[model samples]
Target: MSLTSVFNIAGTGMSAQSTRLNTISSNIANAETVSSSIDQTYRARHPVFATVFQNAQGGNNGSLFADKDQSGAGVQVMGIVEDQSSLMARYEPNHPAANEAGYVYYPNVNVVEEMADMISASRAFQTNVEMMNTAKQMMQRVLTLGQ
Candidate 1:
């Protein structure tokens, strides 16, 4: 609820978005990777996030008695999870990675989807930066008011 808290919240958002971008990059990088077997195929990874809430006592809202004024403090990265969808299996008999049955397994990552996610994550990170800058400017103006 304070100007200082804005910086913390925005910082956390930027961090989360950065993690998202990293996963998008990884997925895109492995999009064309082919494996000899399904078990060896790369799976698309995504970052999971959770919001951190602030309680009325200015601490984390982790207690049952916490007041209703539980505002979002920031974001946290829960974990990165691999997509459980089926891998792409293609019949590339001549390919080096082809299996004995003439099938090659490719990653489930979709380049277009990964690109879209990259753009979204980049925009979210930019937004967080702008928020932090706005909070900084506001704090500066408040300091100038006293002078």
Candidate 2:
């Protein structure tokens, strides 16, 4: 890949991670929310990812031939999806949203899990930024060679 491809790769990575973080944030924010009905309750969401790849040619031999060219450009967010897991149910007769049976339905979002996911997403994003900086430094060094 060319030096310029680095920027494209890093940019895509950052964008993908940003989307992941957004979903995580939403999940965390709604973690404590309670509802009277299952239909109205919030569920934790997660971002799906896909890798963008370039067709690489086959490796070079002795005969005239194109080398295998294949590499990932970066990651992409396929979509954000709600967790299909069951929602949390608690018995709280004093709660406003409790049902006739004194049961309250809460969002499936687990604050601890969401917080961990946020940390992971943030670290991945920071790593991508670091990769871009390294790529930038390398490019700068190459330009310095022209001096």
Give TM per candidate: 0.92, 0.87
Q: lDDT of each structure?
A: 0.90, 0.83
- Whose TM-score is greatest here? 1
Would you list the clashing residue pairs of candidate 1?
A: none
Q: Which stretches of candidate 2 lie over 4 Å from their true place?
A: 56-69
Task: State candidate 1's TM-score.
Answer: 0.92
User: How far is 75's C-alpha from truth in model 2 (Å)?
Assistant: 1.1
Q: If candidate 1 were superposed on the true structure by all CA atoms, what would the RMSD be?
A: 3.0
lDDT of 1 by residue, 31-51 (tens): 999999888899999999998
Number of backbone clashes in candidate 1: 0
Per-residue lDDT over 46-146 for candidate 2, one digit per residue giving the tens place of the 0 to 100 score: 99998877542332323232244447767888888889999999999999999889989999887888888889989988998998899999988998997
